[model samples]
Target: MNNNKILDVAIVGYGPVGQTLAILLGRMGYNVAVYERWQALYPLPRAVFHDHEIRRVFRMMGLENELEKVSQPSACYQWFNADWKVLVEIDWSAESISDGPFGYLFNQPSLEAILDRQAKAIGNVQVHQGWEVLGLSQNDATCELNMRKVEGDGAGETRTVQAKYVIGADGANSIVRRECGIEWHDLGFDEDWLVVDLQPNAGVELDVPDIGQWCNPARPTTMVPGGPGYRRWEFMRLPHESVEDLQSTEKVWQLLSPWVTPETASLVRHAVYKFRSRIAEHWQQGRILLAGDAAHLMPPFMGQGMCSGIRDAWNLSWRLDLVLKGICSEELLNNYTTERKPQIQAVIEASMAMGKVVCVADPQAAAERDAKFLSGQVPPLPPFPGLEQGLVFKTAKAGVSGSLGIHGAIERNDKVERFDDAFGRGFFLLSIGEDPLQSLDEKLLGELNQLGVRSVRLSKDGAPGTCRDVSGKYHQFFEENQLQAVLVRPDFYLYGGVSTHSEIPALVQSLCDEVSLKREPCAQLSQAKVAVR
Candidate 1:
């Protein structure tokens, strides 16, 4: 091992979250590496489901399309009364959501394989198999990591690696979380469950991949679909039942009972484990930090354990890009936990609510769970100001438009024209007239463009413009104070405006420049648009 080599980031695990984070940063031109304890893809059927955010993370790795190829088609999660009567079916489909992709049910190992391949192909990512990280320490500028090759019987030598930052993507029993000296504030109700993974004979249809959750307060089972014609069932163990003892063929058959027939199913795998809901006390401390199970581990009730971590990856990735690339201040990075903590806290609470409602055993508790399920009570989705659907960006007519650019609901099948001219995936500028922005000269505009300054103009809405997405409503909002266009960020935070083509560069700089300068948090820039742009 080259102990003295340095990387832009050092990831502590190579599961789904770690591998995806590595490939994401590596593709962004950052030097990255992984310390993985697993020498190879281990036992299958670990993680069975992932939510929409996972889809977004996979897309960042350029695998969203590929995933659909191998992903199983699943749509509904149905509640059941132990006797097999269906209660309520919650349908999840991503045909209209912006972030894209609803959710999927597939074996975790396969997903990891796909991400691992991408990590290995990247020249900027170096992954070490069977390397157990011993400990780490970091200042603001860099980090030092200690590790030993676990695969070797006596390879006990520790190597030191220099890294600008470290992510703890290990499992719940994370050494990184431990070394950080943080603890989880628990949500109660720890219980044991037995997971049975088996192959069904061709033409056998017992339980649909459409997860059937038995919330009868009687017995709750979460059924998930494995890729390519396979399914697994997770059932809570009755008090005093031992999955270790159930490892016997007869015992396994007993557990598989009710769901599979003796002749229709063949046992492929089974495991027993218990878990509780938890969140990391601290997501980041200094240059060393945490993500995924290292940060939060809720029960798999919502099937969001791994997906939540993936969300952390995407959130952290863009901020890391800004900071590492000299576009933002590190204090803005502090908002990482700020933005994500609330979201994860919600996940933990929701998962806990699920455990309490669905895992009912007592008659009274079961009745309450059943009453809640039957009453058709659905929790409200978290409110985010950025998520309201509509033509989000209105053209602040930088002293150009007759009215605030038109803002309205984008109709289905509406042609968005060309988004290439619009600012996107970053803060950009737009122009409506022929005027050169007043704030910047041609030379300055050229420099801003070199620094990734983006601007565009449409003499009219139908003409050449940056309407990158037409399915989405891109309303025209016109403002008199601004120039001919507007600039928006990836997160859709309003950054600045262009009063003239010349002013576009300075507007972009004003919104993003100070983060790279000396400061903790960047000053907020606000913008106003007309009724429609």
Candidate 2:
């Protein structure tokens, strides 16, 4: 460990979350050091799915082409009864506001390999594999990590690394979380399930099953397509079955007998996992913070476990960058846990609801559920919830305040690119028909500029320094929501919006107060009433 100078940020665990944070912070020109216990990439596939928001993050990282090579769009997810009757269906194939597929399935090992390569290519990123974090202590100024080279030539040797901040992306049993003394709260969900992976043989004529959940009283199971020809099956362990009993090759074959035979498909891997739902009481403690699995864990029912972790990485990186650059007060860090906790809780609740639907073992109850669906009456899927708290502005349409900022393609240099590329990074104030910079008073515009807000006027015709709204979704979105302008946070979340230009000052001031940004000379608000809805 190099202790000559205090580094900007030190990340524990070099998994996808850690690697993503490293790449992001490196791009922000921060010195990043990542320590992981694993000497090499875990060869097995774990998380195999991510949504379009994550795809946008990949685009920001300039790895969209590489990501496309190892991923394929997911089909609609359907649920069925024991007799193969449809209970419910979720259309995952719909185009997202981000102008991309809503969901994608990929090979995790391949994706991690690409992330590792890209992270290593960054000049400011240093990855230290086979290093174990034994202890951590932090003061107001810096955090010190005690680590040991647990493998190869320097085995058993100890060293210390100092950093301004440290992040724990080290999976479920995070040492950083433990050292911070954060308590883990179980969300009252625990189940044992056997997951099996398969690869069909060439020239096999059998049709592969579509992605779906089989909610049977006899044996609840799920089947989802992997990348390309790969497939996955998950079967719940009954009360009578022990972990030992399910681990037997014969029992595994008996479970898969209905789907494939040794002749048609080959077994890739099988493991019994105790799917659980747990979240930490808090995500931050002093200079040490938690992200990814260190902060929360959910059952794979909704396929948001890894996606949530990736979101955590993205959320934390931008906030850390702002704080490190002196653009915001350290108190801004408090909003991270305040914002992410509720969003993750909502995800957990949704996942648990899906779990309850799948884990039904009562014959009569399962029949009743099947009847409810077969009667041409099915519960509508819940809308995706936004952040319930944090740096959101209080206004007439508060619901959309904490929600994600929508994205669309814009014509740039005779080519189309996503809005982020054209608008540039950092806080963005985008207006539909008027120029926010020109309309905003100089006092407000100067303060906003000082806070690093980029003003862009979205127009119909392609013009230099203007987003063209190529898909027309931007104009439609504003028209539908009755919004004339929207302030987009750097993390791509809606900070606020206003229907009239007169409302800009109050909203910007509120945002500055939310982030604890101090203005040199505070401007007075207008007495005129402004409608933000």
Candidate 3:
């Protein structure tokens, strides 16, 4: 750890969120240092689900092909009652607007390993495994991290590293969060559950549930398929069950008796976890920020525990890039906490709601709840919430800003590929009809060019320098929404949109002002289009 040079960012805890942020920053050509107390990946599986929106992020990292190797597309998530009657079913296999499956099932260790490998490959990212963060403090110029090497050659040695900014991606019981004086705002839902992961014995024959919720009052349990030949079961701790009692190996097998015995399966790992729902009162303080489990914790009923953390990383990456590159003010980073807190809070509430459904204990209460759901009076599933506030421009020509941007396969060269792969990353100006550049004045175009924004003209048929919307969804999205052009952020969220070509310049200027783009550039801005063909 070099103490003299001022690094761009220092990340505490090199879990998935920390690694993702490190990789994103490294790819953007920033100097990053990640400190992890643990020298290796946590061998147990924790999170198991991610949606298409997250898949798009993986696509942004250029890891879609690698991700497919470790993930399995999930089927519908169906809930059943004591009598085996269906309560509510969420169809995860349904196609999303992003032109992919609604969700995916994966092992957390595999996902983290993929992120770690990619992050280490980046030229500027340095991983300090076995280095434990001891304390954090910030002066006017930089934040200083005090760390000690916990293992290997430097076992008991202490050192200091300096960075312009520091982020805490440490898990729950985060030292960084505590050092920043952030408190937890508990959502009040807590339960003790046994999480058991196992692989079936060779040639074991038995009918097992595939990703089903058994809501029986006798024992409310969840069985989920984890990739190929792997299964997970979560059994809720009953009223009479004690944490100590449930932790015994003999007792654990008893809970698994209904599903499998030691004869029929090989026990991989089992642990008693008290699932908690909590979010930090403040996510950012001065030059320090918190992400992942350090910022929020949620029940895994929706499988969003890890997904929300990954979202935090992606949401902060671009903003940090703009600020570090001096394209935006440091105050812009405040949007991270402002924007992510509400979104993660919503996810926590929704997960708690689902937890209430699956954690029912009393027979009468479970029966009444199931009856209400079975009698065709069920509540509709909540629509995915968009950015409600912070940094989003809400008053575009069509009032469609703050919504998630759509993705589709584009025809380029002799291959069909994801839009991001063909168009590259960063701010994008996409038009459906005419070339959007024709509509922009030199001043607005110069502003966009100076900000490193790319312009793409999309058409149904191939044109010189224009991308072909092979899926036809991008064109249909424009037609259905009555939008001629849209400005999309790097994280695939709508910055703003214009209904007519004439409104393009104004939209560009609005975005320029919102992002605080510089008027001058190192070189004069040019009227150049990104060559896709």
Specify the highest-lDDT model's number: 3
lDDT of each: 0.64, 0.84, 0.85
| lDDT, candidate 1, at 270 | 80
Regions more than 4 Å wrong, model 2:
376-378, 412-414, 461-466, 518-533
Q: After superposition, which runs of candidate 1 have C-alpha atoms over 4 Å from their true positions?
A: 83-86, 99-101, 152-154, 207-209, 240-249, 375-461, 472-533
How many residue pairs clash in all the candidates, one count each? 34, 0, 0
For residues 365-401, what per-residue lDDT tens digits would candidate 1 score against the true structure? 6666556656767554342222111112233332321
Q: Candidate 3 — worst ten consecutive residues by lDDT sum?
A: 524-533
What is candidate 2's lDDT per residue for 1-533, written digit by digit as tens? 55777889999999899989999999889999999997888887788788888888888888888988898898998898998887888888889877787899888888899999988999989998999999999998999999999986788888899999999999999999999999999999999999988888987655534779999989999988767677888999988879888897778789888878887888888899988989999999988899999999998988898889899998988889878988777898888999999999999989998998899888998998888878977678687777778888878375568887788887766778777666556787777765555455666655676677766667788655566778888778787788888888877889888877777677777876787775666454331211110
Model 3 Cα RMSD, 1 decimal: 2.0
> Where is model 1 poorest over a 10-residue stretch in terms of lDDT?
524-533
Give the TM-score ranking, best first: 3, 2, 1
Q: Is candidate 1 or candidate 2 better by TM-score?
A: 2
